[model samples]
Target: MNALVQKSTASLDALKRIHPLMPWFASFVLLLPLPLLALNDYQIYLLNVICIMIILATGLNIVKGFCGQVTVGHVALYAIGAYTSGVLSVKFGVPFWFCLPAAIAVTMLAGALVGIPSFRLEGAYLALATLGFAQSVEIYIRVTNYLGSASGLGGIAPPSIGNFVFYDYFRYYYLVMPFMLIAVYASFAILRSATGRAFMAVREDALSAAATGVNVRRYKLIAFMLSAVYAGLAGSLFAHMVPGYVHPNNFTVIEMVTLLLMVVLGGIGNIWGGIIGAILVTIIADLTRDFYFYQLLMFGLVIVGTVLFMPKGIGGIIDRYFVSKRFVAAREKTAEQKRAEAAAAKSGES
Candidate 1:
């Protein structure tokens, strides 16, 4: 274990020496061949979904994990982004590039509105507020015929450059990959910045954070807005993908619950954990489709077990391993120092 950790540390150091962004570059290079390695088109599609989920889950981690704000309305922002993009592409004849930015802008406004309630509420109260927003968005989409209502909007145009179009799964993978990497990199950057520290301060204790000169309300709003950018991006990508269809059913309570599970299972507030959780959950959910009702039951059991026995989730375990390694090293150092003192005393007496 020590050897592995040392090797990883050395690799990270080497990467840092090369460039601050070398790790991200390496990650992108590693993922570049994934679609080619897939055995089938379906697997390639799954890769796209995983990338989208990573963006969404990482956004959620920013708010819930970093800022300690509980919100269920993230799906509503996601829905808004999807519908915004779909409407622009279908109803207005806008290209995907324009639609994408429009979707993110709208979601950012909605995110601010969602964050308004956080000033006065926390925990379940805040969750309920967000839940209400989520349900409202879902219901609005279901009843509004222009938005396609229950039937859903379709015939959205694929992204293109000149005559080249991202109409196939293979082409679409490239479209999504760079965005996913940027989102992940942005999250890590935020986590290491002054804004991220302010967010953690607010999460740890808002009152104390205020006392320490942190503007709790402002940071909370920033967290929500930043996270909303990711949701909007993911939703827009989904909206303009192959066959281009989005239903209100996709943003239901169950979907929100599943998103939450990604954060929880990955380790809340952990960037890599959120990414890992998104990948695992996407694959697990896909594989369990054959289990029917047993699938949901299994998910429930896993959630319960995770909360009860693994509250910190997989990421936490990874953290503990490194911590334990450091502790062992410190212990050995102390022992060696004590032995040196004893040897010195014995030599002096001789």
Candidate 2:
């Protein structure tokens, strides 16, 4: 066992030394040809959906995973972003470039509003509060004539550069991919910084974190706001994607549940886990679309099974495997040193 672990450790170390960024580089390279290799536009469209979900899942992970906040209204914020951008472009004739940043700013303010409840509530109370917020947003949109009420908002323009418009899945994929990569990279960078450590400390024990001079409320708000920025970006992208429409029904409780599932299935707090979860959930949803009657049942079973048998999610399993290997390698090294000392003593005595 020790030998096997030592070999595994050595292999991993060697791989890392060879190229620390190799995995990321390889993934980028592989995905570059996806548009060309795709059999049709549907596949490209699915890929675009996956990219947007990646941003959503990553943002949710920052708050729920890193900062330990329970917020179900994330999708509501997402809807706000979509509508904000859609309205700006449709009503005011704002360019897509300007609408994107404006949507993020608006969503950040909304996110801060959502975080206000976290200061006074927690657990089920917090969840209920956010759920209420989400419902309220949906009702507001549904009843407001300016937002198109039940008919929804339409006529949003696609992003463009001069004469070039991202009107098709192929062009839009290029647009979304860069933003997704940057979001993922930025999340990873933030989680590795001092602020990230404070967020994790609070998650582990808020009282202890407070005692250590961490402002629990501030970090929590920051988490929510940062996550809102991600949702806003994703919303803007979705709003501009093919069809260029935004509807109240698209951002309801059902959508919130789906976001939660992505986080849970991916392993809460695991960055890669959220990405994996998004991709898997999207693909599974597509495959099970034919059996719409049993879709919710199947998703429920999957979540239950994951929680019962692999609570850490897939990322947790990977982490545990590597941890065990390192432990075994350390033990083997210690044993080897003791054996060497013993042999030296025996030789000296002889």
Candidate with maximal lDDT: 1
List model 2 lDDT by residue over 1-350, tens digit each.
76786686677677668797654555577678888988999999999999999999999999999999988889999999999999999999999999999999999999999998898888889998998999999999999999999999999999999999999999999999889988998899889999899999989999999999999999999999999999999999999998899999889866787788898898989998999999999998888889988877777888898889889897787678779877887999999999999999999999
Which tens-of-lDDT digit does each residue in 117-234 have in candidate 1? 8999999999998999999999999999999999999999999989999998899999999999999999989999999999999999999999999999999999999999999999
TM per candidate: 0.96, 0.91
lDDT of each: 0.93, 0.91
lDDT of 2 at 138: 96
Off by over 4 Å in 2: 1-26, 342-350
